[model samples]
Target: MQATLTVSELLKRKNFEHCEVVAGKEGLERRIKWIHIVEVPKVEHLLKGEELILSTGVGWKENEEAFSSLLQQLITRNVAGLCIEIGSYTKSIPSSIINLANKHKFPLILFHQEVPFVEITQDVHTFMINAHYEILARLETYSRELQELLLATHDLSDLLSHFHQYLQETVVLRLKESTTHIFPPFQQNNSKQWSIIHKSIIDDTYTESKKISKKIQVLGKEYGELYVVVKNRRFTEENMLALDRTALAISQHFLRNLYIEEKKKRCENEWLREWIRGEVSLPNIFHKLGKIDGLHNYEGGGVFLCRKQEGVMWEGASFSYAKLLLTTLFEQCGFLLCITEYRQNILFVFVNKRQKQTWRDRFTQSLERFKKSEAYEKHAKLFSFISVGSFVDRLDEMEKSYKTAQITADICSEQVSSSETLFFHDDLHIYRILSLISDQRALHEVIFEYLNPILQYDKTYNGKLFDTLKTYLACSGSKKETAEHLFVVRQTLYHRLAKLEQLLGEDFMEPRKRMALEFMILAYEQIFIKKKEEKFPQCSEIEG
Candidate 1:
């Protein structure tokens, strides 16, 4: 229904029978929301835009300049039109005023005979009031229908489709890091055009010429945008109001869904925490898995521990965002994950959903993709490392996986010079062996017995003989590779080697000695260096 009275429609009334359009006939479509009578010379401050003015020309009678100036002011004020009574305090219309009205398309109406100004105002005001009432009624109906649909279905796409049907216009919903839903879906050939338009909307560069957009916010955060395209006509204020109502409805839907999902996640996380800590019995674990769909079918699974770096404060929102990001990344690789925040680390239990033995390959691919994602790059500094445990076949064995992941994370914390942030328990060849030895004293003695002479020499002379020996042994006695790895000349490497041979025996390069030295080096790093730099001592235990 039309929301406002237009000049053309207003002229068709009985009160305007004596009125004649003298100029600006092309502006007959201008909207008129109110009617005002004015006999003043300056009406700029009296009228707002879209008000139809009724004047007797008494203020500018017999003065062409005054009439012209008054006409210019009315046009500048953006009034719908001007209706003037002739032959009363105004002899005739001015040619300059007529020309000005025509030039600016400012409607000028001449009343040949005097008509009751009160009657015209009453007629038009009544029509405007009824029009507004109809608009409110329509809006109420739409809102009620939307609320009913919201109750019937929780799908956002269904809501968009209903809005499309109501307006008979194209509707677009663009969500961040998720799919875009277009009702009455666009043609396949126009996908590229839609993408460009979506980008422009996201960049806030679009002119909004043919469409009206609103933001969909949940919990005071903007999640996406809603766009409604007006195909062939200008969008009225009523359309804007309707769009606002629709956005509110969508936001309410999102909030409802979030509340439901959060409640479910709380239950699942409680069970998962107990299961990880071995507090839940195996039978109860199986029973809980059976209760949750798509979880009982898992054939193999693992654990992931993500810890924030030292000095970075913990934020619940950041942890949630990270969990959401990882869930999205891994779910695409055929894995169902149960994530929870435990003690200073965010833990995830991933179960393979597919019936294939390629979980490892898929997990690796997912991790690599996640590292390259924009979410990771934006929040990369908030986390120190992500450690994954070895995959286990049974659901009851996840406790073992959590323990191993903790060990891997500890090893990751000690390697401060390593650029890699991702660690896997299966990949920790020597560190795994060291983690198995529970006696810290025995491990320290093994480290000292293997290379005490080189350690003492380096301590006395403040030399890098220890580092040089480690690098040399790592290079398998390849002098040229060792020199390059150490960023030193061969002469410097030879001098270090000579000093090393003097301190210990030349048998340091022997096969058995080389094995012992490599193992001892790993032991020293895991025991001494790791304990010194441990920031999350609470996370050191498996219960965490």
Candidate 2:
């Protein structure tokens, strides 16, 4: 069917004695596309390198400079190796030429046997053409498979399972595995694979394969790699080339599927979030989701809001597919959750905690598992953090909990931005203070009332003291920091604090009152901005 040609295979041909392979570096091989043969030196003008260029030396006279010119020209053209036919006229491959080839590390060949040059030309070209054909055929097949994958209505897991079956091959998606599951096959070989196959690939090219190592592409982007380890390790240059093309096709398919899945999730996420916004009752939320199988007997429950920073958290996972992914990640105790709101944000559905003795512990444990799952890490950066607020078990608690989730998630998102992320609500002291500002009306009242004296002071005297207090509170009440930030001396800052205490008839350093006042100021900073937006929606400066 198809011919296989390797560096070692090509060398085994008879009549090609004294044929030496030089410059077999990975750097050299990548630049080569295919080998070629032409009798005319004029062929050099039309040549692209990495080709095996041949000549009979019929037109050349016996000048040393002329011999070296052809050699130099071949090097400049970047031909992989040169095959020169030696005859009575040439009189045993020139010693000077031999020295030059050795010096340049150019592969030089001399044919002493009575072998037809046409035979070598025909065999090599025929093999390459066949390889091109086989590669193209496989690509066509994979292209069709990609089309089917996009058209299918199944979720990510089903699509992947079906894809593997269609190809009659195993496919693996290697995420950064946790201690729980073994890193599956096709994850990645150790670093040795990089050094071993590098010799065959020319550039940071799209895709290529040598033996089991295949670089797979998806929509011209290399998202993953594939390996097809068979019984034979005898992969040649041509063998690898064909497989490279195949890998490109398959990888393209996967990338396309991933894109489509993301788009579908976005549409579904919008619908789901809209559904969550309107959710008042536990069963009502599930009914709107059209996934209410487990909600019949389920009591009220808690809600968690998880947002991905920029893109979908689970690259290929969807809300509909959460059934399978969450099943593994969580205890499958939750049902009908959706990724709603901004980037890959997730909202959960669980049996509402009816018992006062057990308040949100199991739900929190399940959330802890979800945060540490393979899916979350895959798309962690898209959202700065996925936060769980106080779970609301009652209908009235849902509204406050929803707002608390938004606040806690914002704080959680900002905390573990780079190295590590936290899921459990461990820092209760800070979170509790922040949670106090979750009520919209109460938050609004605190902001306006605390700032009332300051706002009045600013309006009456154009005083910088009130603004300084506001800025300091906004910056989380750091003193040396506040004075430097406000362009005031530390003593001036103390004087202003004294004025504020006298004006309000309250102690500025009292632990209880200061904590309340500080939270009120923080609430003002948080919610006042929203009110300003609602007040001036069309103002470009205020909109963001």
Candidate 3:
């Protein structure tokens, strides 16, 4: 708050025909820190000497030059204002002065009531102090209300309503972030939503954007995004920040709640998994747990591994959102499967008479697309990897199938992108280990040896012979096929194959070596891998 001068009040009470406000605050406090005074009415005569001046209109009474000169002098004078005393000489204020004041946003005041100049000066000086006090009070009150909202509620909608009620702006949130717009199912193909909303944001075509429009950004590492905008017709920057704080606060609480719920659900799910597969026969298959469709039908299934990134999902997305997203993912994957949460992970089992290779491929593709779509984020954020178990024939072996899918998915996670589909045994060793090992630790140790051999080879030789061996094995011991696949001439391929065989001291065609090699790959995934995985892990056959 600066020095204030109320012309009407000052004139009515006392006389301070002192300095007139020519272009600044009238009844407002003025902080004209360094000021001056001038009475000249000529452009050349008056110079840039910051101050306020008192005038009687003698120099610019009627002529146009006089009128223009007086106005120009004020501008040139660089004074705060032209406080004019109206009495015998100057009867009424000039129209040009009024016009100029309004044009330049120059503060000006006319004194109609006769009063001494000295007394008016004293009143302006006093009013400035009170104005400063009032401003401080408003700021403090605003801060308190904002703080209250942060601690009060968990529900964003309710919190927003509270803001609308108390905060006074017509606050509303834009759920589908401008960056990512997910239209209702049927209307997605409709481009109208883009023109009406999306394009506007991209171009900042928010020409119609109100004086204050606030936005909350929702981004993705791979998939579609979701933004929540809280709009108000009368919104101001201050009020918008308050709303942003409230929205952010509520979102955080919701996420924290969900994080806890997800853990519990995963725990419950694993218990159910153990029981369903008969790994832990705490009770009968039907014990307390309700039957899930296709539950009994799955003789064998796969596990999908995923990670929902921090702050990527809805602010309020709790375990409920996680569960819902999983169900939707599998559903869209074309499986009528049962899903369970297992500690920071979501697992799904797909069971139907041996699903067609093509259908499995398609299902995996759909999941990949969905993960990359607006429905979920990608790369542990929303969309993740999936590993399917090899088909099993006996119901008694269901537990084996479950563990295989889980471990295979984990192995697949290290080698492929979360956007990948199925993890076949050939691609990831964990699948083989999950297939072979009855005990987890033995599986881990064997894998450690296999990976270590390759690790030492890579670190020591800067060589790629191990990869060559893996590829040859993948081709099923056919020299021609392996050579063709590796894109080397037959003789060159033969030399490399011979060198590999010599190093390992075995024939590439021997069943024993092939089996050991395959099992080792599986063992490596289950035991040696650093991070374990959930059920569904994107295991795309494509490299990139």
Candidate 4:
């Protein structure tokens, strides 16, 4: 039912049969909420909006400016229209007043015969009251039906269908992960047009189409958006109320699903923790997996660990959002993922659903896309490092992959400053070897025996010998390349090289010695340099 009473409709009443619109014909569609009879010159404070005002010209009959001011104020207050009695207080309507109303598209009505103000107010108020009551009753019925639908279905798409049916308009639900669900699906050829509309709405730049949107939230955080396109008519107050209720219902659905998923994840996390710790035997693992729905036929898999940056907290809604985003991204890339939280880090176990070995390329591509996404840009500060383990052939060997990924994360945490956030186990060639060595004393001795001379010389003289040698080795002993890299002239580089040879030995460039120097350089930078920077941050900053 239409909840609004427009000026055009009110003009058709028997009480207004002698009334004629003198100006602002374009505003006939203005909605009237109530009727007021005002004889005072100042009626601004008495009006809220959408009220059809009745007045006699007696208040400003002698002053045309005061009457014009009154009409201007009424227009500013957005009154539905003004009706002036033409018989008693004034014989004719002023041409200036007619022009003013026309200029602002404000409806102006003149009654040739006087009508009872009390009777008009009673008739209009009673009609509006009944309309409002009917609207409320309809809303109550809608709320009841919505509750029934919620209890009967677990799918959000089904809920969207119900919304579409009730509103009889196009509906769109867009989630945070860029997933869109649309009702009254468009034709295949119009899909592109819909995509454009969706993007415009998300960007908040759309103006060509009339639509209303509300945020759908979960746990007090915005999870998605609900949009309704206004087709051929304006939305009444009842329509807005209905949209609000729908948004709330969708939020409740999201909360319920999250609660159920979280409960299941807790159970899975415990089993995964034990399994990754190598406490479960292969036979028992197979038996437990066989009981699950889809884990019985897994071919191969790998593990990855995500560690938050220091001082960044991950709990509650933020953690849930991240988990859902990761799950959606990985599943779209053709991997079935199992996620758990352990030791303040997020762990993911992903298995290839296909028999082919193409998961690596797909995983890499997905990570690249995720890094470029808006979600990552907003939450980048929360993440510090991502360490990917080697792909294993069987589920039993997953423990080894998890351990390697953990080791990679540990290595990255202790290294000198680096902008890279993603690390691969296979790429940790020398770091893996260093991690395997149990004797820290021997490792320190190896670093000291190879690079101590240059390090001590640089510290004693405040020289650039250490940097020069490192760059020279990285340049493969190419003097020109080293000079260019250091932004130094050839003479300066030669002098530094001569000094470097003097500090160590002339035979330092031999194959065996060069290899040792290279390895020790990396180890010293990863271990000792980072510690020195931490101890004397000011000195490190000055040196850089």
Q: Estimate each model's TM-score.
A: 0.55, 0.41, 0.35, 0.55
Candidate achieving higher TM-score, 2 or 3: 2
- Candidate 1's residue-wise lDDT over 1-544, tens digit each? 6667789998899778878999999998898878999988888988789999998988888888888888888899899999988877876787888889999888899898989999999888887788889889999999999999899998898889888888887788888758788887868799776765566455555554367899987533577889876544677877888889999999888767755665578667777887888788777876776675435567778898888667665455554555555765677788877788787777889988886589888987877777776656766765447899888887788888998999888776776456877788988887777778935655555566666777777778977888998898888889999999999999989999999888767887888987888777777666666677652122123233
RMSD values, in order shown: 12.6, 13.4, 15.1, 11.3
| Tens-digit per-residue lDDT, 1-544, candidate 3 | 3234323343334454443544444422222322233345555453444444555556665455675667666655544555655665566666776777666655565555555545544455456566656645654564466557545755455555555554553344455533332222226666764454554445454654333334443221112222222333333334545555654544554445545655565566656567446576423433433244423333334444444446655234443554545554555555544566555555565543335454557556656655565345423454444565554444335566566666676556665664565575445544553645635554444544544555566558855676677778888878888878888888877777666666666564579867887766545544444335522121231112
Q: Write the per-residue lDDT of candidate 2 for residues 1-544, one digit (tens) a residue.
A: 3344444456666546566443333322223345665644445587776677666676464655677777777878877677666674455556787777767667776665456767877777777688778766765675566557645643344444544454343333322221111112233565554433443333334243332456554322344554432222343444454445445555545555555554555666544554446445555555643452434433454456656444344444343234334532333444334344544455653444245345456555655665565554554454235455555545434545555667667655543445544354445565456555556454555555556676667668776666676666656678888888888888988888777777666565466766777666555544444345553112233224
Q: Give, for candidate 3, the lowest lDDT window spanning 10 residues.
A: 535-544
Model 4 earns a TM-score of: 0.55
Say which prediction, candidate 1 or candidate 2, comes out ahead on TM-score.
1
Model 1 residue 147 distance off true place after TM-score fit, in angstroms: 12
Superposition error at 368 for model 2 (Å): 15
The per-prediction tally of clashing pairs is 0, 14, 54, 0
